[model samples]
Target: MGRTALIVIDMLNTYEHEDAQVLVRSVREALPGVKTLLERARAADAPVIYVNDNFGRWRSHHGEILEAALAGPRADLVEPIAPDEESLFVVKARHSAFYETPLAYLLGRLGAERVVLCGQVTEQCVLYSALDAHIRHLDVVVALDAVAHIDADLADAALLMMERNMAAELRPNGDITFGDARSD
Candidate 1:
């Protein structure tokens, strides 16, 4: 086995969208698990990557994106898992983190053969990203409790699809492992 990375997807949100109410509820529940994974990954010296949507901000970078999310109405939600200086960030324009982004290349460079996924929109971004990662031959593990969703039904179905079709390992955040000294 090579290295493993923790990929946090679309957690930096303004929550100013159509499904904000529903999504916010799920986010609140997932927050603690996401925080735990972030701490564990950092402590073990494992790669922590924040692959976030750019919100169509063509010129904005990660810092600007983070600032905007923090300044939003739901700053409380964004603050807890905000990226640290050591966290690698990839600004994505689409649902899948691997879509038109440098994420695949970055993973390659980091020697990360396996990726542990967490963060929001389980039925959307998280599901799509997992498929992309699977097709790219990278092992994928989704932290179930650490992912928020807009629709519970769809989220459940997505999880089943990821495990049944994509062969993704679906596990709770606490059960996730970074391997070697990083194992927890």
Candidate 2:
């Protein structure tokens, strides 16, 4: 039996990128699910790790990155799922959270053998992160309704790949449960 961690990826964003409008639209639909997962994870006392993109702000830390997102026009989206004091933060410069990041070591330290992934860019970040986690032999779960995507078709294909190719479980946020490792 092993612990489970909720990995909220790249939800803190300024929505100032090339396809941000499309991404924001999907995110709006997915927001409630993401919020629900956050609450459930918190209530269960499971580790909630926020693995966010640094947005090329080399000097920025978690606080600074969060501040920038909250100050952006799309702050509403970030507000509901903002990382609390109990949430762990990891800044990543690449698509995969584990790439050049301490996420693997952190997960090991926390004894998290399973991870539930939620957040933006289903076709990109989420896809890559799932593959990385799969190779590392971590059980991966992707919350379908809790993830936003830029392209619908690509996102669909990505989810299939995560499920069939990577063996990542695909479930809606409502079905996800968190807590003790043995019970999970």
Candidate 3:
């Protein structure tokens, strides 16, 4: 069987943008579920890849990004889900994790045939990343409760599209089992 990886996208946010408050609230609501999923993935020894937006800092490294987020207003969100030493980090310039990022190559290197997407902005980054993953012929799974969004209606629509168009599996965090049981 192929390997599985958990893609945590845009969770290291500063919450300083236009709709930051809304997004932060949603993220906070989803924290418990996301945390549980993280623990399960780690325990299963599944690869945890953090895909974050560079926030226009072309030269910023992961350390710098972590520092900025930790010092910012949304530190609660960033701190709880901070990438550990064993976790992989990828900086993306766009909504999709695969867009101008090394995510695809990294997944390939890890022999990741399936990816569990969890994080913020469900309608944007998660949706786009799912699309890209579909195009790459990778099995996509979205943790419904582990992802937060700025708009509820749009996020629901996006999830529906992913299910119908991309055949992405939508399941709650509790239902997700990493490693050998992932394919089921």
Candidate 4:
């Protein structure tokens, strides 16, 4: 059993895009599960990493991003899952959290061998991050109910690909536990 960390990807979203409504709906459905996972992870003393998109704003910081997101149409989604003071925050320019980001180095520094992924765009960011983690030889576990997708069918395909090709575990939020009591 290795050290574990929880990666919350791209949840601090503005949700002002064309498909924002669709994405928000799915995120809303997953919010409860995500929240529960967060609480459990904290209780287990696992590190919480928040990998967020910069939204093409190279000069933007985390506070700015949070402010913009909370003031946007889907504040409901971003507000409830706001990162706490102890959480690690990383900004990424691409879909994959490791692409052009310090996520891999950060995870290594934290001594995290197993990563549990949770957040938005299941078929996009979450999927790409999972692939990147797999290539890094890190054990991956994706919280099935904690991820949101714009397209249900595409998300399902992505989940299957992750499970088959990357040997990633796809489990629901209730089944995930960290530290000594972790089942992964």
Q: In TM-score terms, which candidate is top? A: 2
User: Per-residue lDDT tens digits of candidate 4, residues 153-179?
Assistant: 999999999999999999998988787
Top-lDDT structure, candidate number: 2
Error of 1 at 138 (Å): 0.6
- In candidate 1, stretches whose alpha carbon ends up further than 4 angstroms from where it belongs are 180-184
Q: What's model 4's TM-score?
A: 0.96
Better of 2 and 4 by lDDT: 2
Off by over 4 Å in 2: none
Give each model's whole-structure lDDT: 0.93, 0.95, 0.91, 0.90
Cα lDDT, model 4, residue 45: 86
Model 4, residue 138: distance off in Å is 0.5
lDDT per residue as tens, model 3, 105-166: 99999999899999988999999999999999999999999999999999999999999999
- What lDDT, from 0 to 1, does candidate 4 have? 0.90
**What TM-score would every model get versus the actual structure?**
0.97, 0.98, 0.97, 0.96
lDDT score of model 1?
0.93
Model 4 residue 130 CA deviation in Å: 0.2
Using alpha carbons, what is the TM-score of model 1? 0.97
Lowest-scoring 10 consecutive residues by lDDT in candidate 4?
Answer: 175-184
Q: 49-77 in candidate 1: lDDT tens per residue?
A: 99998888899999999999999999999
